[model samples]
Target: MPLVEINFDGLVGPSHNYAGLSLGNLASASHGGDPSYPRAAALQGLGKMRHNLNLGLAQGFFAPLPRPNGAFLDALGLSGVEPAGEAERRLRAAAWSASAMWTANAATVSPAPDTADGRCHLTAANLVTMPHRSQEWPDTVRQLRLAFADTAHFAVHDAVPACFGDEGAANHMRMAAHHAAPGLEIFVYGRHTKDTGGGAFPARQHEQASRAVARLHGLNPAQALFVEQSAEAIAAGAFHNDVVAVANERVLFTHELAFADPEGTYAAIRAAQPEAEIVVVPASAVSLADAIASYLFNGQVLTLPGGAMGLVIPLEAWEHPRVRAYLDGLLASNGPIRKVLPVDVRQSMANGGGPACLRLRVVADPAAIDPRFLLDEARIALLESVVAAHWPEQIDPTDIGSAALARSVQAARAAVLEAAGLTELA
Candidate 1:
């Protein structure tokens, strides 16, 4: 009852709240001559910006939300943060400790003030899993704790080392057993024990996903749903925050993103609670129109909406006309819209996330929320890809033929190496 809204985009790592500025897990941040930190100071990247907007959506149902400081330019207070491990615990004993983390699939970065190639990125290891992965994302954990502390358990994929229930089949059992929430529950959707070990996705990824679900059992949730997110084929392409079936009002459907099983999602939700309202988020983040565009350029992507249904598209369709036009407008204007430009098309196509990925709605006190109201999702896309041909993200001019973007697939890959490590963990 305390959590009323969910944002897929807003679930990145936590150094700050959804309504707050993007922060990094200094422990996992890219060092070795990487300027991702300073760059993050000047310009909040599209992915990270979208994360802020997604968190803002929670304000509609939650009352008296404070306005976030748009400019966290000098806010690298991460001097004390640490990656999850023995050292991180040592640092947390005194004061702050990152509760949990979001594995980042898309990275939201910013350029250092007045610098072109120099940039900084604020991220978590929620979606990405590699060598540089984090055991927890301090920023995301903060938001989840503030918003979902009352829930039985928060959702996460268990594709990493040292994850909750991964020690055994009882791994799920082990995680659930350790959980403190009276009714905590996590939904493991993929091949936990499915392929035993060698499925299309690495065996570890499946085990980790299942362990995350298993970790939720201790809360003894009323029920948890599981589905096969990936088919026997491709790894990406099925993320969307389209329809969330509450106990069963109508089925909260998002206008921005969609899923392969929209109706099924609604059906499953209705089966649980017939009285829940099925509110439709037709205007949140990116719309069906944007989906159409991304479908063209970007092939497919993934999404996480807390426990709600999330949406995803591919980066291939980012070149669509409507997407570019709309995004260009966001960058051109100077207003609140610019602040959330990351949520629009800019981050949508560049990173694995879309507008729905950014932001979370905090419900510190249960009494403050309305329980059934939908939030506004007004955001314009930014097209930073126009100069994709230049360095920083240097693309070949011959390949671009005058239409250059800041990053190409290869460039983005190199730019966010730390993020890549996060994926390896998964």
Candidate 2:
């Protein structure tokens, strides 16, 4: 059986709001307290899925976990306690966070071909870098178990210990000759505690955590390349590796400064995969500022049905003069990326997520995945209608603590789950 990369996108939860929770994320801080349009956000995501489906790419959906998470509050010793002070305010803010909508941080996946067990392995991310997001793993694991439950085809493991922060696929990249073949898995981390190449931004993924994941999947150390993320990139708001670099099959599209040592990193990747295609976008052509602002590298690079590659980017990229010109040049030339498709995901963009952030890439047979999580035209119609009818048009920061808002979010999620015949997950 032939294997292919399937994009499993997280349904933007109704709790989607801008509370400015993530310290390193530029968009989250810039748009803090802004009114969020949940209905529009979700529909935009579903539209992207539909577009991919029409393009004959395999697309999947990961259900949003119920929010206003009481468990998280209870762990912090705040649940069941009435709000009377700043601590309560902070706790409440964390409770209403829609951070889970960026499912790229959900888990680190080792496709069946890469793992020793021959079963695709996924370990939920601990996400300990941010307070609100730290609470996602438990629910994310539950959803993962349901979506990829076949023991013969999938192995869903618990998150790594909390002491070691793990941000999942956001910091991981893979490349192979083909989806089913053995490949190189690159885990990018920040500066080590002992090595003092510094930055103010937090390093979300720990090297120890990455090693733990590799061992859990029984991956050979030679095939697993652990590279340090450039402190410069982190300072520039490339908080995750996906922000600076992205890979599909044998090609690596990245900014020159994506790694601590560009020369060494490129050599290592090439050494691992002899036929690797590395496309480095120099800062001279498009400043790192423009790349970060436009999320140019966050675009999804897919091997289209016709054997050509397409870069599915956000509208922001097309609007940026420098980045747009660069993309146009690449297309005009005989580059690996043959086309550029711009998508509208302004709602997620406003909150610091782009096309890549919305999806988790899993290399597997579509038939091996649970049928309920896969999407079709009819399923998309049902999801779109549910979002249109039940999702809130706007959710303000002040609305985070509203009991009515919580109930509404739950109702909307339940409706979508029912529509997808995934009520068991609900």
Candidate 3:
């Protein structure tokens, strides 16, 4: 039988934050950049830049993941992995202890005091890489994973495999499925099985990607499928390497100038499966065929304003109503997003990420997908069962308004601590 229903609640990371983080990576990685330009954001400082704070959503979004500065003081193999202590260790340090870059902004930014009235404070960990992982969006990737676990399963090896070079093919593919509009299995054509470039795992290495996708079954996005390499896709230029497809077999080629014309790919797909809902759209302004006919080989070669990529919008775009709608619709429909980043990053100086890129579409059974996907999650369910067994008469978080959500979060934090086997925190 075809893959259908999934039990997202079955999967949980150390933190409730991770659930949302992983799912966000799903959608964020699937997103494509503004077509007017081809390439995406630039890498930050050339060296191990000093640390800086990254500010993001207070409640609905993920906080940040900082790195440990010096060596460790491990006792009893139980390092600083506990929830409460982890939070303290991550958020305790002063602002600029080490050289760090804001993966979201792709520029030199500093942490600012968030003066929100009633919101749960998020923690950031001290994350580090030798010589620093170039341009790879480590922070954004982690935060997105945290967002994924918020609603979907958060498995580091299963959801985001550590084997596929440094790019994390498993996470990228799971993310592809998570963001795909409903009713369609989003496919990224020209996917690489292995990371050829020092950073990116182009859709070309199909072998590694195929195994990665195969293992992601039974999670929140049990239905999302991914495939590696296509004969037609190989003919396209280097940039035109990826293709995004939906569950109904609808296909969309990402950019204009890549390899062969996506118009041809669409034609082939249509001929192969007449019923397949395939569309050859471009991230740029022109049609795929027209773009090829005009540039790559003949016609008039024109250069757009921003590099192959276009102008980056502002970060506030996340708060925009239309942007919200696009995100909501993409989640409900299962559309896929394709961008050019080592990981799933929307590091624009302006709006930060592209459409449907910032939000995490962590799906469970449609029947179970509540406005706040966290209500019936298995971990919470277990916590509820425990609370009921110990003390029947208890308070519910919904009874409070935004003002008291912070307290509710604290209670929830205590419950999480209990679940994670740390008594001091509880």
Model 3 residue 212 CA deviation (Å) reads: 2.0
Off by over 4 Å in 1: 1-129, 135-188, 192-220, 232-267, 275-348, 360-363, 366-426
What would the TM-scores of all predictions be?
0.36, 0.97, 0.33
Across 93-168, the per-residue lDDT of candidate 1 in tens digits comes to 2121111212222221111111122211121234332212232333333432333333323322223334422211
Candidate 2, residues 227-327: lDDT per residue as tens digits? 99988888888889999999998999999989989999999999999999999999998887898899999889999998898999999999999998998
Model 3 error, position 341 (Å): 23
Question: Distance (Å) between predicted and true CA of 262, model 2?
Answer: 0.8
> Positional deviation of 283 in candidate 1, in angstroms?
22
lDDT of 3: 0.26
State the lDDT at 3 in candidate 1.
Answer: 29
CA error at residue 229 for candidate 2, angstroms: 0.5
Q: lDDT of candidate 2 vs native?
A: 0.89
